[model samples]
Target: MTNYKRKKLDAFLSLSFCRLLSVIYIVHLPHLDATIEVTLRSMVASTFSMEYPKANRSFTSMSHLRRQLLPKTKDMPSGTGFGLMRLFTRKSPRSHSSKKKLPAGEQESESTTSTMSSTETTSIHRYDSGRRYNARQDIPYLLPNDEEENDRAHQQHWMINVAFGSNFDAPVQDALEKGIEVLDSGCGPATWTLEMAEKYPNSTFNGTDISPRFPQTIKPPNCHFFIHNIVDPAPFPDSTFMFIHQRLLSLGILENEWDKALADLMRTLKPGGWIELLEISYAQYENAGPKVTLLMQSVVTYGKSKGLNPGAAHVLDDMLTQAGAVNISSRRVAIPLNHGGKLGDLFWDDFKDIFMALYPVVGRLHSDLADIEEYKRFLDACKTECSEHQTALYWYRSCGQKPSNDE
Candidate 1:
């Protein structure tokens, strides 16, 4: 046999032996002495860890394996098997020499440093139906991260600007004009961040997202991007920014995660700093016809399955208040779709792109939309319905301020 085949055979034989030993130990665990039981457990854990590193093993799969191999016993501690698996599989901490030192004048607090270091490992991206998606298993962001999506993001930014008449509504224009730290959470492609950075050169802008779609080499001097996950703690020190902007994260953040996500954003804001959020009322379009409504219903059902709230826009104000934000205010704009001429056409196109991107997700939930051709036809029907019914989508922009220290 070839060397590769030999290695495969050896691995298979080793795994089979390990399984047999595990079965035997579990069956005779009650009769075995304490030291022998511990030794057997250690041996099994070490073998598993040696065969599969932590990165190769998912917590869910490992938990399932633990359940299959070990039953709850009065003698054994709860979660003993799971804990042993984790302990053996845990990777050693990186040495200080391997750690990247921050640039001068960019020092971070210990907590922020830890958060940044944890995100140093890049997530693997997945491709389906010729579109790329983020590999963050925890997040349910059902959108492509490829160049086509970036172009759509750019178009969406301009459409929002036209609809709202400005890039932002917060009263941080003067601070931005002078010089202050700013953050753009969930900034896909960094369209708004790059534009704002160019418009207000005095202020420094930092954008963070799980995907690295933002510019790296040709970005403005004032703009910076990081491959950071927003669901986790913000990778910046407390009270770090005068302004924090997050938009279009309704699809990405789950309903239960919104509170923690907002809390983290608030944690990173300076005292009395403004934090703004913009989101479209997903699946809540006005005057939607039958076809449009059906498509939206599928989207809502898919979102609910993933623990997401499709109508997060309507509750932004309440969420901010619960996060302890003060001076909370909101603005809602109903942008016409397919009937408002140029802006409407732009929105229609953007909506089409969104629906097309969600094919992989909605297709699974809806059999009629399983095929791309059928999906396109459904989108065409929705467009005709929007044009006929004068459908409009509501965009919500909410702003709140961090309480000043004295207050």
Candidate 2:
């Protein structure tokens, strides 16, 4: 072959190689392995507009190609090698040190480490202090005690009860059979306590909340209600109770606050006792009715705007696992939140009826409810839907237990 033709063929091969290298590194290598090699490859491909596949071959066959294209290298590029080397092996300015030591007068620069440590300590203290302030301010709103109807604690209790439905009865039976005593932290209105006491007279149930919404007339012999705020540690002694249950408490808890709360619950449980937690993970909804998804999305957005944790839905599993809970299991229940299910379907009928009763409570709580009229129309449609077909709302239930023996 002529020198000119061979040179052209080599040039074409070089371009093809560059493209190949770029693709493999950019799209494939990073996924296959998380190493400094992939990072370096990314730097090269991104810094230069060289296609990845071509770059891959150029990188692999560089030694042989370098000898073949010696004449072209001199005329073709000067900074390419230096650029690639710099990209592949970056040096930190902060890490580099000068050979010359500091003068005696400048020896105090060593204390910069101490200065940074002190600054970090101060920053952490300030952050914690700010959180304390926010929590205190939020407590009154989160756990309001006023009895004039539509109160925060009342609404939360109702929401939780409706959320659990028949599943609540099963747990009460299980706890009773297991001879478990319950400390219902942040309990409002003593609904579960009252019901459990009636159903399981042998098992003891204690309900505590910052709010004093305990029903005077609904008192049961086996059930007791108290006032306690979980912002501080629970007042009960460690390893005392058999089972502890809490639900629908995300509004009152910030992220990671559940750790101390769970630890406290575990501490309160006996060695062989269980602790059950049920949270309505508001984010997991599928096959939602027409306005349900929109309303849910709006509510989630508004919750975030109001400084609530929209991510609270999925954090419970991690939180429970982190808190040393064992035998963790979760179930996702899909209930249609709209007005389009048959009365013959038990879950759907109850779901529609509950939404009709509860959406007004939600409307009272949220000022940004433009769909109030639409909600009513949907309720009427739900009534019609309930008579015709089966549809319902849904929620997720996750439960975990503390270890029987930490040893």
Candidate 3:
């Protein structure tokens, strides 16, 4: 082949190889450690830029391709890896160490104050056991705030919808259809919020969580998200929302804090509006195997040590009644795991993810499975036991209405 043709062929082949590697890395990004991911991105960007110095457009196109191909959850952050990709193209700033230090007794300037705030915001999330968790000491959430957990939350949303045959059981469909204000407290990932917003465009929906894992961009006009802990007082004014919903916060709310949390929900709820809460019966699985029982018991013991109520679902009715709510009602559903076909399979996967995410705490609480690999093996055994024993999880949906002024 001529030199010109040979050079062109070599360039094309090199570019193709780099593109293949990019696709592979992107496909496995969720499973990769953060350090490994950064290394892989750096390698790809360096190699691609070196071979195709004038191909910056190609690199940008690759970013778009990656965004499109990655599995999308309702709360997937937009332009997730684009910022990392930009690091390769831009020049690094001078080291802060080289700057003059502030004199003693000298307060930081506005710019420095804003920079520190940004740093603190980033530090709100910390990594443990390869999972990203909310680092705020006040918010006692047990799950990780990472994409894997978001995916699991999304799956759990659909599973609950199917099991209960609706997103909610309260008698607020007419109000929602006609346009009403709704709150989804402790709304991890905002999966349910987004779905409900789309279903009832007239209704406005607000989602709040301690972690900012919900989608920042790419949400319906009626849907909004805020970073607020429900343990604190309600951020909204009194009687602001026509309906309030909270789910699965049994792990986050302390046993003694249940009254306060419910009171906060009731405070934001409009008089005569409905408040609904859905929670799993922690450590109360039916037909549990020996291994399953042991693991669950460990979870309950660990939760109790933190003052969390593992059996919060059982007392929802009494709590609502004490909170001055009227017409309280509760429903129960049994979700089969590992034996009920597709629904069971989905629930099993969700359970496994939960187990994996709790490793940091469970491993410490149970010394026998301190090593992660061994814990995983133990998890596999639990899965087998679940299938053999026909394990089932129960969920409670409790709802009540605030008394109107005339009442």
Assess every candidate by TM-score.
0.69, 0.52, 0.72
Candidate 1 lDDT score at position 236: 96
Candidate 2's residue-wise lDDT over 1-407, tens digit each? 96535544564665556456544543453255446555644443344321122222232122212223233334534554423322222221211111222223432221122211111112111111011111234452222232212122322343444455643522346658656677877666555565555566678788887656665323445677776777567778888787777766665665546677777777787776666666555565554554554445554555555555545657667777887877777765554433332112333433433343334334534444324455556656654543444334445566676677753
Candidate 1 lDDT over residue span 228-301, tens digit each:
88889878999999999999888888999999999999999999899999999876778988877776787788
Whole-model lDDT per candidate: 0.73, 0.48, 0.73
Q: What is the TM-score of candidate 1?
A: 0.69
lDDT of 3 at 146: 67
lDDT string, candidate 3, 80-133, tens digits: 543433222222122211223333454433222221112112334544555566
Q: Which candidate is the best by TM-score?
A: 3
Question: Candidate 1: worst 10 consecutive residues by lDDT?
Answer: 51-60
Off by over 4 Å in 3: 1-122
Clashing pairs in 3: none
Weakest lDDT window of 10 consecutive positions for candidate 2? 124-133
Q: Considering TM-score, which of the candidate structures 1 and 2 is the better prediction for this target?
A: 1
